[model samples]
Target: MDTVPETRIGWTFLTNHARVLTAIADNPSVRIRDIAAHCRLTERAVQKIITDLEEDGYLSHIREGRANTYRIVPGKVLRHPAEAGLTVGSLLSLLVQDESERSPQYAHVKQ
Candidate 1:
């Protein structure tokens, strides 16, 4: 009997943090549940990531009734020495796609 090779998943180029941030950039008014679903992460994970971003001054939120409206702090610098001078806005521009330009897989994802 021939044994089939098991394909192992490797590290992704982007971290879960970047994924969550990109999701938020796509929709500032998006909900935490929505972000979790879109990023394939737990709500708790998303909440923690959001808190971390806020504490570092990379992100902020304004309470609007039952929902939170997030705002990415503009002109904030990236952390890594290799990515010196890179801004969150620039990173999002590379990762985020306009609603009309997104592929079919992301069509169901809210903007």
Candidate 2:
């Protein structure tokens, strides 16, 4: 794995898939470009991740004119055996923060 030459925060605890899902959870109508930017990933990578999530029943999207509106499949169990009983809703609850709760002033404050 390539490490960041600066901070050296090479890998994160959350997977790319989890990151994408949380982005969608934060804003159902978010664009793929925005997600790519937020996750620091390529747009193609984000598209593939979205496809994987949709194919596995973890997520779904609706076509609305020029944009796609996503709808997470809540209550769907996570795939890994370690997270068997955990649902998508629970996982998102842990990652997706409310806008008001995500103020920059509290960025360093511990929960």
What's each prediction's TM-score? 0.82, 0.83
| Model 2 TM-score (2 dp) | 0.83
Cα lDDT, model 1, residue 72: 95
Q: After superposing candidate 1 on the true structure, give the runs of residues whose Cα lies further than 4 Å from its correct spot.
A: 1-8, 103-111
lDDT of each prediction vs. the true structure? 0.82, 0.82
lDDT per residue as tens, model 2, 7-67 = 3367768899998998788788888887786777899999999999999999999998888
